[model samples]
Target chain A: MTVSLRVLDDGAWVSVNDAREVSVSELWRLDDPSFCGCDLPDFVVENVLSVGVDGRTVTANVYGQCIGCGETGVPGWVPVGRLSDGKFVDIDRENTVLPVYDGDDR
Target chain B: MPTDVERWKSEVYGTEIREHLFRFAEEGWDAIPEDERDAWFERFKWWGLYHQRNGQESYFMLRIGTPNGRLEPGQLRVVGEVAKEYATGPGTNPIFGDAYADFTTRQSIQLHWIKLEDVPAIFEKLEAHGLSAQQACGDSWRNIVGNPMAGDDATEVIDAWPVIQELNETFKGNDDHSNLPRKWKVSVTGTPDGSGQGDINDLALEPAYKEIDGEEQVGFNVRVGGGLARNEPRLARDIDVWVAPEDAAAVAGGLSALFRDHGDRENRYNARIKFLVDEWGTEKLRETLQEDYVDFELETAGDDLRDQYTYNAGGEGRNDLLGVHEQKDGSNFVGLNVLVGRMGADDVIQLADLAEQYGSGAARLTQRQNVIVPDIPDGELDDFLAEDLLEHYSPEPSPFMRGSVACTGTEFCSLSIVETKNRQVRFARWLKENVDLPEGVEEFHIHLSGCTASCAQPQIADVSLRGMKTRKDGEPVEALDIGLGGGLGEEPQFARWVTQRVPVDEVPGAIENLLANFDDQRDGTETFREFVLRHDDDELADLVEPEETSYEDPMMHNTKRTWYPYAEDDELDASPAPSLADGTPITSDD
Candidate 1:
């Protein structure tokens, strides 16, 4: 089954199969220390640059800043959620410490 | 590969989208297929109907494009009546009430909480009054902006209203120029005061004098590819071509075609003609237009009147279209400041009545999100000014109130991260009550744009504020990035982002401190923009001292997650959306 993924409304949100699944303006904690100076990078998503599904693990490349150090740029692909049986499964992204799939590796 | 938006536009777009829009309107909201909802919503923008943000599912934001912001006799009343009757839903704005109209910076009107079912009737009502939303929001020629009182202003170089009308009629419905690579914004300024802010448009026609047929004739010099959006700001570059008033439409059409054919379609981020201009400088752009796009020879650049331009220049003359200005016909045109550009429907109707009673029924909207009532005779000037309606929408308001401009933020727009209009209104009111301007300083512009989309034109103001986020006491809160010293004039400048992320609560205090620092350290009678230009970025940053003051921001939490920021129960699950025509929520069990 094809899970249609899109970044709509001028990069405001990510839609999986025409349903708004993940949106910008949400704060997430990135486990990567290089992303910012804090013990954990406190990331706020300003724009959903693009989205993809790698092995049912949904990843969103976003453009925003870390509140800890005020560093602004695209910080790799942060996992937002996952797809199960071609259906999007929500994760507690705002509460979890997610790992960043660095652009260097991709 | 083309982006999803490009693919959607390629498949079904432009004027043809209207037929399907009406069909879906008649059949109801659910008639649109679930899988195709995104595509249809994207297409609906061509008709000026934008699907409201995530939680508010079925409602739409309807934008009515008034070419040159010109409202004919009695047309103003029609818009007010439309707002009162149809622009209502469950949510009510705390500041603007349930039904109101927003005057946009590009000289257009927007009404929120519009249901798709009522669109056909609304279109009929709007069409009856010579108003439309066609090509208003999509990738086409958005509302043509210029001096609000183009033909009537006594200080204008030449009457450009007829030329604006000709261009509006030529390209508005023409299929040849209706579909472009990205949104095409055009500005035609007949006035030398630069009220149109032509430097920030994709296509600009600024007044000039050219030697044609051995005589000095007044025409317009062409510029292309200026926009402030997506973290990239560019001033429209001079293309070294000039056009007569009669041939303006041809040149505009040709350039629109040039952008349509050559602009990047694959990457939406790199799609604006500004990027294309950045890629192929002005010389090649002009060469391409002369060689392939146009049939006749184009004239070389003419002598421009840049030295006389001072509207919002952070200097003395005509900072904005506020107060009364003399018209050519021994009459006056009053520029009323609509705070944050949002006016209630009752005020709109009363103003329409006042316009017919005291002046010409014709009204116009300025690029600063204000309104102008033209043709008020000398005898009726005192009476018109005395009207109770003018008290709120004052012609001579405080500089803080008049200079405040904001974009539609998290309230109804999807791309905005924070609440804007109400917050700016609060900021302006507090500033008016608390802060005092330095000696000889009257106008202090502070524009608040919710994001880098730059809809509020934040990059060209005395104080610029864009939405951001920060952690306040271990909780995420709304914040703003502060910028200083940007204005348009003989020499235009973009505001430098001095302070990074200041909490929303501290923004007013930050402004107050910045002003105090300028007062303490600046030379006599130096303007804020001048003061900013004197110092480096780090020095300016030090001047912006963000502290907690008595001014409180009610929306400190994340507003984007809510269904409506002002609602009593604003949680996404508490929304009564995806509803039927009668305002009944449609549940899955239904």
Candidate 2:
């Protein structure tokens, strides 16, 4: 119920809240770490698509609309890597595992 | 982030109501458990914030209220930072979509695609910088707007900004107003030439004076109960009271308090301040306001203060914020147009930089979403025009782009009945691509708003579109309710709603037909506004009315002002009282 996921930006760990499904290549391009530091070892990346709010659990739908889109339907999430021109690049990924935490876990 | 959303365009835009949220609210949003409520709030906030920043969605935009439309350099910088940090990523539509720092017609700054989560922080930062976004949303007293070039304009009868600021402070966070039956709008103008929409506010302070014991007192000619929205878009009726500048804020407070105590709350449809005014009449409301004045511990204006401040429209002269103008101090000022008042943060920072670099650190905002950076040297004119920003913001904007206005409709405002932003963009694009408009049409106003609340002031546009919902093929569909022949400034006329509902898909075609009709019947460069006025509804009904007419004739609603033809020198055209010159420093008068 509680999974600690490392933040891609500065490698800081936070609790995952929820996880939703999203594009895989987009997730990789967004700079998702190859190995997420979680409580369990050998946590498969194929099933660990995204980390949700508290960064606790990994679920199939982690990186889907919630984290990326925020709901205004305008994408607020930024990709991990910077573009050649130093501008922010949108991550193009699908079916990626991520860790998520919910308020109940907290 | 792209979805195979071609079939669900409305869903992509989030224009359709969120049934889940509606159901949740109805079942009782307040009844949800605390932790569960937090989950929903965070989720929704995150969703709105994400899409708002992503720039893919419509309607969930953010507006930073610039009261009296003034922005310090630091505050503007934060706005720029927000835009760059959130809305725009590379290769996407710029944060502004097109323009930058849209100087709104009401002297406010509206930025689109703002996330809800970021809003609290930005608001906090703004407050730290002596700025705030209170009353910027919900049905409350919005940013107290006056002329954009308030103190700078030479023709003003009094320095309206000080009085405007006074009223703003009194009501900005007043909880009594925060939960009113409906939103209340107030406008104050010292100029007598009717430069401000005083007649269309819950309370408007126009220029007027009274005689008491042989002494002239400059003060306000009060009007109350005016409002715009769907079924009730009428101008305020006069209350015949004189309020001094010092007492103006308290008067507004008293009036709002009165409305809060007496306004109906059971039925939302009839819950506006105007309805209360309708129920109580001006005389009775004034009496109530006076009684509340004592309870609120407010002061009244003296006789001499009244004589110096009241507006007299017949006193002479008017300025419509047009091209190439001279300042009273032998300098020059030029009005630029910012179409629809949508601007990017980067562009805004650049404009702010330009204002600082090329001229004085002073810029004048206009009621038209444009700005005039004043005190520019004659030598720098060419260099200023050479900049790429000019191409976008239009230092010398055309009539249509210059005067066009569209409020945040279903996109951001929950009260909207249709999508206004996309429609405005679509309509403007269509006109630019297809029409060959004539010249010297310096000032033609086009306003689009969702529903009638008059957020974009459709009642005053040369051509206005108020949102509507109608059944199409037995299904409820979004549409526009078009009005024509409205004009503001000097001589104001409330536009008459001509068509009840025209389907959204058919709006462009309808506009094309209307424009073509205007061109065919033109009498030499007679601005689109004049042309529309010249043609009666009977004439236009031939062009726009559908063949199978599903509803009653809209012309039946056009009965109020049939015989009131245009009059140039009517008694109502008096000039405002003497105002402080533009850009003048604050006085102890308050």
Candidate 3:
């Protein structure tokens, strides 16, 4: 199955075409040094990487700015949501409520 | 300095970090081992480089040291050119737009979105203009702060620019004093109003006069230990020792050396010079300085001109250096507000050009995040006022707009929980549109810090807001706790927390109610800060509290008592009784 992904909300949100077959995890990968410090990196989301899918689980490496010391781009693989029969199941941090896809709330 | 921080400092000083930097530049960021990257980043701070946009590995923020916050027009032009070329902004980014540059509170210029690779070239450009980022950050002495209007102020006790420049020259890149327990902040101000914020610095030199050989000589009265942070917020205390103009640098160097050797290194939080001063007391610290480092015999403080603990001579409000004020030479200096100290590169260049065109080839940055264009001739006043740049960087701003000071919030600071720059600007605009203060109240400082680090110095503002997070309807939202009645100068006081958990959306309305209440209830002579101070916490809370609105509950629909009931007697009997089994009524019987 073909999977489509798009970045939204100024790099704050990500949407996937198939929530069931493709899981979403926040990822951080090494960006090109040339693209480094280019204001905004040339990627779907800078510091986030979508690794290959294993069966139904799509792994991603997440790097986020730390709220404690203002350190950013530190890596940690966070399982944002898993796809189960086309339904998105979010497992991210508490209080991080993901938006429901159109016609999927039911 | 905690163990980790101390280790990092030693590694920074011991290791050939410059060599490693060269290697990283040659091999690229990816080539650096993951374990060493953090250390490299820490070392980079010594060179005035920080990962901007909050630790984004790709981009960096460079801070250039400006001794006394003075910059030549040519130097500023070079900075502007650098911003235009390397810096991003003046575009879609909400925080820092295309070619944006910020005038930091330390009297230095900060440019964001700088690439690691472009930094070498930027440094070269800065050096060519006689500017350097050396020792801008790290544990070493940061920017040596001086009164922005030092030489020009008619009320100035002495010109501190020469002393400030000398100290900067002596300390910048000096390895002997490079590493310390923590960052050391120094301020020197000759203005009687204490515009340089001498009391809030780790080491401050305020103007004083003494009779030496029957001649009244101007000198500096030393102050130590003032700092603002979460747990420790103490005002700097007088050390009772006075240094002549020539010995100011020596005294400063002595104090720095004392702190360097004796300051606490076990805990980073307790490592500031303030902590050492607090521990040993100013008398002991002064004795140590006089005995070991200072070669000359220091005189006791005599006839201090500084307005310590008070805002003005009248002791009413804080000194606001905004608007056009006449210099001692009859020329005028115009202080322009740069909203939260953020300025576009083009605007900076324009300011530099205007300074050269209408006045001396100099622009001064104030601690209040404002800039002053000084030395404008009387004949050039009209031309200066008519300049297009003044429209954006207003000399005369509204109370809310003028007093807004925000730290580099979550937008680029990793330690921040909420975005501060845009939020502060929006909030200021909202207050301007909504709240109307009584006449003669044009300056009220409102500081917002994203976290407890207090980089924005919220503790000293007329009204301070520290960032917080609160849940509203089970959804997390940005909020700020309210602090009121805090100020600097003669009567310096840390702000007291009046209320907490004010949601970002409700801040404007809350402030509107508070100010409206103040306008109505305050005595004709009382300032808003005084009004806040005069009232109890409960009273202050009442002023900012949201208006209570009554709404009919659906659960109480059947239980409602009406003069005329549509229900029949049998239907009325089916309604649940208002009284509990113990005869305690749930609703009022009236």
Candidate 4:
């Protein structure tokens, strides 16, 4: 099974199999201390730089700002969603306290 | 390796895409393979059909590129008819209603809610009336923008209408120049008031004079690699190269070819020529063009007319083309303000009628998102002004109403974070009704762009508003990052983002308070831009006092999460999209 992953529309969206799965402007509760000093950065996803797969979990590198700390940068590889049977499954980014992974491993 | 877009373009792009497009339109929406939808959608932008954002599938925003924004004779009627007939959908905007035409900041017309099935018919109508969408949106020579009053402007240094027409004919569909790493925006300015806004285009040809063998020769001075997008703003750089009016197209082609060969293809974000210019500098770019691209010898920089620039300069002079102005032929051209740049379909048709009855049946769109009716003689000026349509699209509009510009936000664009057009409309109306401009300030520009794309040209306004998100009372609400003191003229300046993340509802109050401060602390008759220039960023940010006010913002919630921000249900699940030819929602079985 194959799932095509790409970021199109000038980083405004993350397209999974020609469908816009994740979009910018969504406020996410991110658990990434490296991105900012805050324990939990209430980050706004401004631009989706790239998307890739780390096993079945779909990860994305996004550019945005931590509203709490007023720090702006990419929050490494945040698991935006999961791929199940070659189909993208949505992550409730608004509710989910998404854990950030070290992006350098990619 | 090339990017997906580059590979897609290599496989099929330019004039070849039109055949597939026509076939798809004829065969219906389901004819397209599901896996190839993204590639096809991206390619469709070449023909000026942009696939609307998520939740709105099978519909497009159709752009008709009227060269230099010139709609000759009966062309405006055709656009209005296209909008009325094909530009409608399940969702209706409460403000703009069922069908409306958007006059873009790029001097083009955009009709939203266009079904793939209706594209052939719409293109047919537009073609019959001498208009085209080819190379309007995608990474090609986009719509050639210039002084809307090109031929008729009394203040013009040279009549650039012929030159503009020649360039349009040469590059629009030419196979060699049809593809590039990024979108190419060109401007040819002949007017001294700097109406063409050449400072912010990929390529600019501003009027200049050069001495050739002891005789004064009229031509254009070249500038390149200027654009505002993705938080990177740059004014076009003077390359110290001038070209005669006859050699303009040749030099343009050469520079474009230079961009095509050298511009970065791997990173779409860094593909704009502005980035290339950053790496190479103006000297290297000019050297490369001279060495490789062109056959003829390029002239050194000539004496330019930059000192005379006034349009959108943020001073006391004419910043916009609103109100009646004189033509070179001793006639009148009326510039009407189309607030937020969206006009309902019927009003569009009516305006076309008025243009025919009053002027030379020609209408031009300006970079300020306004319309100009040219060649109106003194005899018919009074009757044209008295028309009921002009009351709404007024030549003499309030300064707030006159200066309000916005981009298509979450309503249609994928790049947008918040609702823009209607919100700006509401903001303008509220400001017009409630607040007064500080004494002697006739023009106060407030531009609202939905995101970092900067489609509203927010950086060049008195008050710039870019979309963002902020928490209000433990709930996420739509917000704007407010900037101040940006404009174009003899000197161009991008707005300074002094205040960050202001809730949308409190924006009007902030503007009101900021203006009140300006009114109180001015040194005597200094313009708003001047006052802003004198103050530091900290002082300016402090001046922006955001508070709750009588002016309400309907789109406080996350508009990007909705199918249509203005729709009654306004939910992602409630969308009737990815529809069939008859607009019946397509059900998918997994």
First chain TM-score in every candidate? 0.94, 0.17, 0.42, 0.94
- lDDT tens digits, residues B1-590, model 4? 78889989999999999999999999999898989998999999999999999889999998888878888999988988999999999899988899899999989999999999988888888888898989889999999999988988888888888888989999988898888998999999898888899999999999999999899998999999999998899999999998999999999999999999999999999999999999999999999999999987889999999888999998856898889999999999999999989999999999999988988789999999999888899999999999999999999999999999999999999989999999998999999999988878899999999999999999999999999999999899999999999999998999999998899999999999999999999889998888999999999999999989999998899999999887888899999998987889998775
What are the models' TM-scores? 0.99, 0.63, 0.78, 0.99
Number of the predicted model whose TM-score against the real structure is largest:
4
From the highest DockQ down, the ranking of the candidates is: 4, 1, 3, 2
lDDT of 3: 0.68
**In order, what DockQ does each candidate have?**
0.75, 0.01, 0.02, 0.81
Each model's lDDT comes to 0.92, 0.51, 0.68, 0.92
Tell me how far the alpha carbon of residue B34 in candidate 1 is from the true structure, in angstroms, after superposition. 0.6
**Candidate 2 lDDT tens digits, B1-590:** 21111112213222112334334434432333432332333223211221121112111244556766666545556666666665431112312353233445567666553433244455556668776545554445766766555565565656777888877776765655655655677777765446556666777777666665677766776778876664467678766567767777777777777777787665445667788878888778777777655344322333222222211111122324545555545455666666676667677778768877776655665565667666666777678767788887675665457557887654334344456654676666656666555444445556897654567878877667876544457443455667777765444567776775676666656666666666677788675656666778877655554332212222211111111011121121121111121212223242
TM-score of 1: 0.99
Worst 10 residues of 3 chain A by lDDT: A18-27
Q: Give the runs in model 1 whose Cα sits over 4 Å from its true position.
A: A103-106
Write one digit per residue (lDDT tens) for candidate 3, span B392-449.
Answer: 8899888788888888765555445455777788778777776787767767778898
Q: Model 2: DockQ against the native? A: 0.01
